[model samples]
Target chain A: MGEFELIRRYFASAACAAGAEGVALGIGDDCALLAPAPGEQLAVSTDTLVAGVHFPEVCDPFLLGQRALAVSASDLAAMGATPLAFTLALTLPTADAAWLEGFARGLNRMAHNCGLALVGGDTTRGPLSMTVTVFGRVPAGQALTRAGAQVGDLLCVGGVVGEAGGALELVLGRQQVAAEIAEPLLARYWSPQPQLAFGQALRGKATAALDVSDGLLADCGHISRASGVALVIESERLPASAALETLLGAERALQQKLGAGDDYVLAFTLPPRHLAELQAQWPQMAVVGRAEAGEGVRVLDARGQDITPRQGGYLHFME
Target chain B: MGEFELIRRYFASAACAAGAEGVALGIGDDCALLAPAPGEQLAVSTDTLVAGVHFPEVCDPFLLGQRALAVSASDLAAMGATPLAFTLALTLPTADAAWLEGFARGLNRMAHNCGLALVGGDTTRGPLSMTVTVFGRVPAGQALTRAGAQVGDLLCVGGVVGEAGGALELVLGRQQVAAEIAEPLLARYWSPQPQLAFGQALRGKATAALDVSDGLLADCGHISRASGVALVIESERLPASAALETLLGAERALQQKLGAGDDYVLAFTLPPRHLAELQAQWPQMAVVGRAEAGEGVRVLDARGQDITPRQGGYLHFME
Candidate 1:
């Protein structure tokens, strides 16, 4: 079969095997038609993960596929949009059937997890890379953004941070730990969960929000700049998994928590009262910091001493 | 500057320079939020053009930008969707300032031309490629689809065909022609206009439709397979421009008309009554054939003898 036929049969049609909601038409048309309910908005995001650059060239295809969809879908989570569908633009050096099947399986799994139906996409021959454009539906005026934070808002994370960064150090051989400590960390790096439900629950509660793909400090900086407020993160309150602490000791683990990337946890700003109310339902949302009437990010030790690092995130080109 | 910063400056923010409506939040957010008006469904399509496969590696960046967006937008046109917004995923091998400027200009100009606002996108470093995902609004259940064509419907093309195919010959140094012949053909190839207005006009009229990127004969085959009907085209009814004829003899031009790709015209099915009515409004829609009871596509000579060709469309991987 031709590559187009291969993609149509295995990838495109398989994406809809379990059926999809909000799609008027899917898979077999020039364009997929999506019917979001009246008074709802569509949340869209695109992310490209290049082989060798974004991940190791020899990584498992299944994990790669899962990571790719997860990365893009996290944007919808950040926006408090419920996943509707996604389009995959895949560039491959060759149509390796085994790799394609593994990738398809991985994509299928992730799509099911995130409720993203494969709507439409294009496949081309080139270096191996995948670009996923995700679409979600959010009620009008209810989507979260980084520009809505205000002074006196509690800066909270949906869950623990920096496990992915810790995983990266192990995977790249920059550091090592026992298999027990490494397993969960690697899982966090390879298949980070997008906090879709928490984001939806935040709807009108969180003043501003974003998924923490960059380190916690760096992503909070985005909230700071966009919302025109300062974020003061309390060092003692930084959420770290026991695995991270056991793997790297407290100080180094704290560095990973502060400066490393790809956590996919949500860092959000909300009034203290709202945080208290939401924390009652979602106990994992820890208040690590607060938004203030200033600019940029400031870190304070347990005693409120200045402890901000020079660099807060990864920049691919600059690196 | 880092890759993200550079993209924020040149590509991402530039997407919103003209201000896109229906987009509640655009660049600099995790996801772009778009609000389609009530009763409208979102039409989404994605197309990727890879260097050395879809286009030459050293082509003009500006024209490449225009061509890339035009190609994907054609799908929306085929679906009779009104242009809404688009996201770009650009992967490049380097960060040349001039090339980026030229590309952004081309993208800006084409987005304006097609009325597609750039809402969000990503920029990555890799082997050069571009993926554009476009969104448009079509009233629920009113979209034109390949499965909607019925037997006895008149098959019409939005405009002339084969110009881009002829131009590709000169572009790849496979052929040469006079400046006059090359000018129009090259323009057609470099910046083919998506028939957005014509498509919107055909809404509630055309039974089925698709953009003719893979040559008219090939795209018609798609409608045939999809609609469970046959498409019969008369050789004499094929539309070829004077430039196409001048570039190649009438016989060669006719072959290109049937076999070559990238015309970006619309081939649609319209009932005789609707055909007549739409013709009164859009004279450029030339009736070249009709749908009949069968499967696949058939071509006939002016005298009505079967002249079915061996190949239908250009498949990138197969080729």
Candidate 2:
């Protein structure tokens, strides 16, 4: 079989999903067809991961595949859209069957978790890279956007932060940590669990929502700017991971928590009235701060004093 | 502003288009939203072009940008879907403001021409590469796929072929063509004009359709296998560009037309009764062959004898 036919044979079953109601057609076509339900809109996002840049050059292909899909699906989660389908454009330096099998295994695992079906894509020969564009369906006018935060809205995060960045330091050999601690951190970095369910649940509850990929501080700025309000983020309530705190000290963990990227956790705003109910439903959700009537983002210490850092998150091409 | 913000600024206005009616959101969010009209389904496709592989390491960024969108948009055309939105995932070695400006200019030109809005994407640091995922809308059950060809169906092409491959040979310095012949061939390679209008017109009338990216013979095989039939292609009916013939002669041009790839034209099958009307409307369209009962593909010359090449088009990771 030709390269295209080989891909079709291998990925046809890989694209099958129990939750693929939105996919009218999958794989082996010029374009895959998707039918959104009545009064629903399609939400789409694209993310590319390159070798030696998004991850280590010689890292496990399985992890790379999982991480690629997770990052793209996180955008769908942030938008409160029901997972539907995704297209993967993979560039390989060589056609290694073993590598492809491992990658497909990881991709299938993540697809199963996210309820996303692989619909269309092409595999080409180039420097190793993978670009996944995920699609989801959301009711018209109900998509969680960055422009909905209001004054007095409560700021919350789905989970802890800085674990990925701390793990990245260890993987890059810039830091040392015991294997016991490093294992979970690296897993968090390599295979993040996107808050798809929490995001879907927050649809009617969240005033604004976004996945914290570019650190809490920077991503919070997105909500602030888009909503034309200011975010008051409390450092004490930043929800730093225990692994990060143990690897780096508490003070350094705070720095990483506020400045690192690739968290893929949901950060959203809820009304004061809905806070208790949501918190009761999701015990791990952390109330980090509140939205105020202002512009930009303000970082507050435990004493409620301004202590914003100079840099917020990792900016590609610039950093 | 950071890289993402910079991209937003550079491409926001560029994304504006006449055919953006289906795009509910264009860029700047976690995911761009698209709401197709009721009774319409979305057609999605993804294609990636890598530097030194898809193109030279240092070609004009403007052409690279144009080619990227054109190639992807062609898939939408093949599905008979109206242009809607596209997401770009660009990876570059470094951030060059001038290069970005030129690239955006070219991208904007094609977006306007194709009526495709740039809904979303992100840029990362890596070897130069671009992945564009295009979305379009087609009425339910009206999409022309490769699995609909039948016996006696006339195989046709929307335009001439092999111009791009011949141009590729020139660009790679494997063949030398004079400026008069070289310019048009190179233009075909660098900036293919997708047959969007023709494709849309063929929607309900054609039995099966696909954009000819992998040359006529190879792409013809796709329709044959998918439809569980056979195709009899007349070599004499193959559309060869005047520039290609002038540069490589009749025999060599036929080889290039039959075996070379990168021609973003449309190859499709239609009933014999509808042939005259379509041919009258599109003067460039060529009735090249016929679908028959059997399997695989058979090539015939003017004398109606089998002379199929041992190979078809370029296969990535192999050639």
Candidate 3:
């Protein structure tokens, strides 16, 4: 089949493409039309995953599909935008029917979970890569950003970190463990659920916010640099999942929690006044750090001594 | 340099990222924020250009950059949407500073001409490819689409076609010509302008519209299928530039005019009543044919004989 036929068979007939709320027009057009509410602003982000670079060159297409959309959608969560639509630009070496079907199934499942409609996309022949561009809407002047953190704000995370990082060992066959430890970590790696609802709830509450893709210390540095304040992380308070601890032990888990990336958890700064209220609503949200009147990000040990790591986060083009 | 530093040096500090009208936030965030006018709907489209497939494996980075954005922005023109912002997902094999500098210069030039803000993007290490997702805002209910063509509506194209097709010979080193002929043809290949203003002018007048990217015959088939009508093209009336005819003789030029793609010119169906007024304003716009009660696209000769070629257009994965 041709490119158009492949897209029609796998994607256009999917459930998410069946006229979602904000999409005025979907596939089969020069452009997809989206009508956001009168006073809302659109949040847009684009992410590309290349074969052998972002994921294993030979891996499950279904999981890759889910991970691709989730990775892109997390940017919208960071902005506290309501999911609206997305466009996928897929480049593949060949048109394999089974692979496309599996990929589409996973993509549709994630689209349903995220409330994102598949509006439009382009499929071409080339080395395998997928670029997903997600769109979401947020109320005017209410979207969360990384530039609003104030001194004395408590830095928090939406959930446990480093599970995906720990899972990398299992993915590369470097570690073997019980199903209990492996399954959860694999799930975190393959199908990270963007903290969409929690991010939306952060509107008007969290001082500054972003999804943690580049490790805690490094991503916190983004908040610090953007807001012109220092972030002090209490390393002892970092949350580690039971599975991660079981697989990698305490010290390594701590290292992974601080240094490894791809967690897809929301890290934000909230005022102390609103902490109790937000914590009451989101019990899993953990306070791990605090913002101060300084510059840069610092990690503090139990003894209140500086313990920041030399390396920050994953740098894409670094050798 | 790291990926972030490379982007900062080459892209984030570029002129296009300096806060355009519709963009609330440009780079340095998880997602960029865009706010369209209150009564406008956002028009979005994504296009991917892969190295060795879309363009030559080795070519001028500046020209490649210009072509990539222009190819994507054409979708906005086809929707009759005013250019607003775009996010580029660029994957490169290495962080070559010279190539990146040239690419960024060309990208900025087109972004300025197209009135598109550089909202956000991701740069990574991989085989070179670029997926550009462009956003534009069209007045609500006025965006032209391919589903609105009516029987008896005149089929029109915004400008001449086939120059880019003729230029392919020069690009691939298959033909040699004078500088005058080569310059214009190469320019057409590298920098075909999107008919943004012309498409906007067609908003209320044109019944259906799209940019011709997949050859005239093939793209018209899309309109035919979507509008549930047959498009009859008078092959004798198909416009061919003098440069194209000079490069490749009249018969070959005619074939290119009918079969070549990548023109980026707006093709639309308009009521006959609106033609004179629209033509008065857009003198380059030409009447090529009319819509009829049937299916698929048909090309006819001056003698009223069916002369449609068996091969309609280029297919991505046909081999």
Q: How many backbone clashes are present in model 2?
A: 1
Candidate RMSDs in order? 1.9, 1.7, 1.5
Chain A alone, TM-score for each of the models?
Answer: 0.96, 0.96, 0.97
Please provide, for model 3 over B103-125, each residue's C-alpha lDDT reduced to its tens digit, 9 standing for 90 to 100: 99888888889988888888988
Q: lDDT by residue for model 1 over A109-220, one digit each (tens)?
A: 8888988888878888899999999999999889999999999999898988889988988877798778999999999998988888888999988989999877788888
Full candidate order by TM-score, most accurate first: 3, 2, 1
lDDT of 3 by residue, A122-223 (tens): 999999999999999999889899999999999999999999999999998899999988999999999999999999999999989999888887899889
Candidate with more favorable, higher DockQ: 2 or 3: 3
The global C-alpha lDDT for each of the candidates, from Candidate 1 onward, is 0.86, 0.88, 0.89
Candidate 3 matches the true fold with a TM-score of: 0.98
lDDT of 2 by residue, A59-115 (tens): 788888889999999999999999999988999888888888888888888988998
Give, for candidate 2 chain B, the lowest lDDT window spanning 10 residues: B11-20
Candidate 1: CAPRI quality band: medium
Model 1 chain B poorest 10 in a row by lDDT: B11-20
Error of 3 at A97 (Å): 0.5
lDDT per residue (tens digit) for residues B1-319 in model 1: 6655776666653466324667677777889888888899899999999999889988899999899999989999999999988989899888888999888888878888998888888888889999999999998878999988888999999988888998999888898778988889999998999999999998998999999978888889889988999999887898758999887889888888887778788999999888667888888879999999989899999899998889867875674
